[model samples]
Target chain A: MVFGADRECEFLSAPRPSTQETFSGQPLACLEVLGRTMVERTVQQFFQADVEFVTLLAPVALSHSLPSFRERNRALKVKLANDMPLAIGRTLNEYSRNGIDNCFVVSGNLYAETDLLDFFFFHREAMRPVSRAVDHDGPLDMWVVDTAKAMRFDGDQFSKDVNSYLIGGYVRRLDHPADLRGLINDALVGRCAMRPSGREAKPGIWIDSGAGIDRRARIVSPAYIGRGSRVHEDALITRSSSIERNCRIDCGTVIEDSSILANTSVGIWLDLRHAIACGDKLFSLAHGVAVEISDPSLLQPMANVVHAAPARGNLEVIEIEEENLFPLSTQEEAPARPKWQLGANLIQG
Target chain B: MRESSPVIVMEVPTILNDVEGQAFLQETQPLLEGGRPCLVLDCSHLQRVDSAGIEVLLHCMEDAMKRDGDVKLAAVSPACAALLELMRVDRVFEIFQTAQEAVQSFHTPAAIDAPVTLPWYSHPGGLDALKAAS
Candidate 1:
């Protein structure tokens, strides 16, 4: 279960700007990387290692977390919990109630591709209270422990400073969006165990099966656009960017070395470089600036974006081919810009 | 791509805001100084254009019209076109899909779609366009 506050949203700005009333607090766990969340990725690692009966805990309501994430394996379970204390308490209580001996405690906020089976067996054989994976940074907080014995029955506090076993493959504690940036670069360079969607459009670029890309758009090397995303005309996605599922890239925007989270719609005529866009909120991971875009015409949430018909003709196919042909279109015309409200700043960030 | 036909072609950068628009006017002032004012503004690379870009285009268009010539936009991106259309300036310029097509429009004067009915409240010389431009 993912129960840690080391990298939780404690000191960040208000999750929503005042202008938006319908904004829900979407956790970073739902921020899809290569079409998979950190939780989903961690769960997949366990499933791949032939580990059965896994349980997950998250901060958000189960509705927001479980819709798109009906896992491949049936043995996985999910629960709603707020922080590490509650999550740990719930996990141990449930395990104890079920008479389960040892359970794997995986943090939803962390992503590692270690030999999970080996780690479990290592913990089983070590005859210790817990056996956690330790990377160069420190303990990854993912370990196998006798839930009833190690955790307090009252379920309030447990010591995190435990001895760890170094069984490192590709471990990373996603403490910040900046940390995700390194993991993205690692995944792009083929260092990590994550997989891209569909076929590789080129050696480095990966476009999933159902992405919409305008013919006028230019995608440079080492980019990944997930399924059901739309890239509009004259848009430029270059230099190691990742756009997750069902996201929309409006006209004239340039995204370079950025990560656009799922179900988010990026606005027109903007430049995004070395950043992370979660929903309508933009965070310049490079500049440490976070701004909420209230204009729906600009950046907004569209969970139903995948259901809409994508742009057609040349952009119909997920053409991963490196072709920059500007095919002439008679239908081309300058559409109107969104009416700017009196004092609403065009580029807030 | 510079095309030195009877209709001179001037390339526009992707971003054409106030500063860049002013710089563009300065760079092209020499061409408009003494020669025939016929010009084709290539906007193939122009992904964005603000009100200042619109002002420059209209000013150059008026200057060309004063000299009995015209300015046409060629290969304007969807984004540039959208902003122009939103401000109702799309009707003011003779637009083409390609630079070659825009150049060819100079030979056939009947093909030009000059702005006949602009919104009376908004004129390039007036404060509305100026306010909108900023």
Candidate 2:
């Protein structure tokens, strides 16, 4: 069995490597790279090792529930807890009571390809309470813990100076937003085992099901268009770029070496190069700056556009199609003080 | 009447939002309207620039172009440079590493009007050789 921590709020900033919230407010592990999230891919790796049951511990409830994988695995449990140490301790105690000898405790904030079966064998041979996985860089946030012996110990104390298992596999610490883009580029170029979750339509171009690409739109090699996303006419997606799920690339826009996150709408006639665009926020890796675009004509969240309805009465509906209209109708709330209110108070006085 | 300087260098504000963009445009209005104005915008202090700021830059360029003048950028920060490159504004504006370099560039002719040498094929017998080969 595998018990992983998908701590969305507990992100680490690099250079110092201390706990800090991501500037985008989205955790790196939870962000999708090549159509698959890092946490999801980590969970799948454990399942491939013939693990019977898997439990995910998150600080807060996930906005979207993970796939249960009922047919592929025995059971999948997602639990919420504020205290990670206590949660891991309690879970290990439960596992030990159920007669489970050992369990893998993986920090889902990292993408590691360390062979779990090999790690398990190493842990068994060493006869230690825990075995921490290490690479050339140093110890990763992955450990194989002995549930019975570690039942009394918290998650932090369990892995302290434990048996170190050296791994020569791919490992990426998903700490910064730039690392997320790097992961996407690495996966596209075959530097890592992580591949795009879509079918390779051409030599290097991958297109998922339900993606609509106009005939005039050009997708050069090593690019991906995700499911339910639309590429408008004359749009150019090239140079290891990925347009994730349900995104819209408007006409004449060129995406070069960039990752457009899920549920984003890039406006017409724009050139996005070496950047990561999530919703209306665009982070340029080359310039090392993140900008929040206010104009819907340039970039905006797809959620806002998808749910927007035309205003009633002589507002003169700008666009007949719901998708074309700017995402402003829904954003404006009812005025706190109506113009008629002040006039009525004056008349009453 | 005061003689207009051959080249004008203007420093951009740190933050070029909507209000600042309007003020910047108003400041450059005279230089843009002056005949054949060569302006260099110093972007060394520019930290953030929004769409309104971009529009102001474009408007300044448009006015200069109408008056047979040009506007160039100098010492652009990476953030502002990326924003310009994203919007493809870099294609239109000539960017320089320093304001002095941008100012110096105005003195040097970008292109020569007259050809220095004739093509070898332009010789009298060159056409005869071409006709025979054809």
Candidate 3:
């Protein structure tokens, strides 16, 4: 089971970017590690360890707020971790009652590049109350817990034990904003176990299969462009930058050392550097400021095609006022009349 | 589709660049000028259309109108739809999902058995239908 805390980062002293601000309305688990979410990669780890099925425990708010999480978990036989606090005791009790003893509990916000099968086997031999993933720094909040022993104590036991044998290896806890940058950089450098979306066009650069970059677009690699994303003409993608799925970089935009989240639109002629652009809000790492861009030409939301398939080759882009597509009020409605009404009027005529 | 004797369905080329667009205009000019007032441009195969292509389509629409004829588009691909919308010329012409439907529309303005029951304006002929003569 994966545990997710929507807790504010203890690191950011003031003006802490909320979880929604940090992840474009997604929970921490939904943050892309390379191209995959932390939850998906964690589940992949469980399967690699030969552990079948999972119970993901997340805050109920997170469960409802993130539709993508629901989509990611839709395929697997894993049980939904509906409530964050109540689920731990309930899961342990259910396991104990069902005579299911050994189960792994992993934190959802981290990706550890360790051999999970080896760790699980070690935990099985040691037969401790719980054996967690640990390095010299301390416990990484990933562990194998025996349900019978877990049932004997409160939910706090999962957090209490650090004496569990150290499986000295690498782990990325994506709590701080800088740590997130580290994860992307690590993924780019081949230090992490994850893979980027596209074929390796050149060394240290990865582009997704469904994404597109115009011939005039300049990409100095050691970077990644996620699936379904588009880099328009004369756009510059350089210096370890990552642009996530379905995002559109308009013409003449320069992106340097930034992470543009999925479904965002970078308007034409803007310069985004050392920042994280999520939705309309851009958080600058250089100045430690987050500002919301209200200009549609500067930045917009790809609400319709955000979750769609890869970018189609040679598809023409329609440049219409977005309000024409979705009008909130009666007066500003689209000029295109409904077909039925048109037919009725035509027949009457 | 209707069994209308005078209505002719014409298929537009897939790629309507400048050359193809000009050719399309030349090919359709005779039919439009021959007192054939109702024409359907079947766009099921039309994958791409540029500014020149839209210009030619508009020209045919203009000629058809002078002869009391109308040019309707059918089965427009998303790429072509976007092109038309980008040019803000989508409202100028009648559009349908299938050539059969567009042809049948010439007979009865109301599509009785069509699956998509969206309300539409069949003819502007470059002006509002109610404000102008049919």
Candidate 4:
């Protein structure tokens, strides 16, 4: 049994926009590395593990507002209540009554590339009543509990602490933006040691499955694009840039050393450098400032820009003749500068 | 024109092409010498820029400022923008939204528009003219 903490029926029933919205001036959703919504990606990982009979526990009032909560599999159960501690306890009690022996609980905002069910099974085989998924970062991302060890009188926090193991990805709990960056960089450099089975491809550039890169688009090495990111024609991505899932980078835009969160659409000809965009909040590394993008269509989601289209739209659909930004004559002249004359002469002479 | 008045613009290309830093500087140097106190560079067309390209821009900026001129950047591509920001050089120069803006800044009220002309590189024609006069 897998229990997702933020997916109750009540949260799903409420009317909310599909795009991200700021709740009380706070960023409500977490954006994962490679442009995926943290919650959506976490749920998908659970499905990938093939664990049936999942249950979502959410606040009854919040359940009515969250759209992801409304869509559920018939096999998955959902329970709603005010207090998270009580709600989880009651669900475990109910599941125990139904003779379910083991349960898996995970936070909705975690990004893990590991197989969760296998991890849980390993814990069970060890005869551990409570197993926590503790990752390299030394905090727990998930908790697996044998129903037999669950105490009836024990509170929610205590149950979580006793049963949860630190598991999944390079780090267990991502507390800050820098932690997320560290996780991605470590995963790319092969320091994390968590590659999905198969002939391991070196991580200079790891393009996930289902990602589409246009032939005309240029992707330099050492970049990681998450699943479902579409790189349009003539766009450039280079130098330690991580584009999260479901992001639309328009044509003629360049992304370098920037983290564009999931579901954000960067306009054409815009320059985003050293910036962290989480939903509607944009943080500039140089300025040490954060701005809230209130309008999704007009750069809400983060950052606003007003500019003409980079390319002319030919509605008649004439034959397209793409021009190279840098011609061959120009490219050959870069290293020919006299400053490196000695080095070039030594090699040639 | 004065050799010190070099205008540097860092270009990060989005498409893979053969344009080199020397060619880029060569194309822009003529405009910089034509009484343009501030050199404006548009990097919107660029995609990928190597470390050599960055060094070229820095050299140009240093040269231009040495002769009492300024190199301004405009419409920097996102990749190049990030690189400059990462190197902390984006703060070193005035970055404008468009080349027109950077150019127009030269005509601002604070500018004196002093006609301080410098000697140009000794071309064959100029050297021949000087020899004939002597």
Best by TM-score: 2
Return whichever of 1 and 2 wins on DockQ: 2
Candidate 2 local Cα displacement, residue A1, angstroms: 8.9
As for TM-score, the candidate ahead, 1 or 2, is 2
Better model by lDDT, 1 or 4? 1
TM-score of predicted structure 4: 0.49
For every candidate, what share of the true interface contacts is present?
0.00, 0.64, 0.00, 0.04
Docking class for model 2 is medium
> Interface Cα RMSD for all candidates?
11.1, 1.6, 15.4, 10.7
Q: Considering TM-score, which of the candidate structures 3 and 4 is the better prediction for this target?
A: 3
Candidate 1 stretches with Cα past 4 Å from truth are A1-24, A60-67, A82-87, A97-99, A153-157, A303-349, B1-134
Q: Each candidate's DockQ score against the native complex?
A: 0.02, 0.52, 0.01, 0.04
The 10-residue segment with the lowest total lDDT in model 1 chain A: A6-15
Q: What is the TM-score of chain A alone in each candidate?
A: 0.73, 0.78, 0.76, 0.57
Question: Across residues A308-348, which tens digit of lDDT does each residue of candidate 1 receive?
Answer: 12222311221112321121112222332333111121211
Q: Write the per-residue lDDT of candidate 1 for residues B1-134, one digit (tens) a residue.
A: 12233768999887777789898988877677555577899999986566667788888888877766778999976556545643457788989999999998877635233333444355756866657765
TM-score of each: 0.57, 0.77, 0.57, 0.49
Q: Predictions ranked by DockQ, top down? A: 2, 4, 1, 3
Residue-level lDDT for A187 in candidate 4: 56
Say which prediction, candidate 1 or candidate 4, comes out ahead on TM-score: 1
- For model 2, which pairs clash? none
As a whole number from 0 to 100, the lDDT of residue A219 in candidate 4 is 67
Those runs of model 3 whose alpha carbons end farther than 4 Å from true positions after fitting are: A1-22, A65-83, A304-349, B1-134
Tell how far residue A260 is off in model 1, in angstroms: 1.7
lDDT of 2 by residue, A1-349 (tens): 3423211111111121123324345556666667666665776777677676677665542323222121233254555554557667777777777667788888767788777777887888898888888899998887777788877676467658599998898888777777887888888888898888667767777776556777667788788887668888788988889998779999899999999987899988889999999888888888888877776777888873232132222211122232322222123223223321211211100
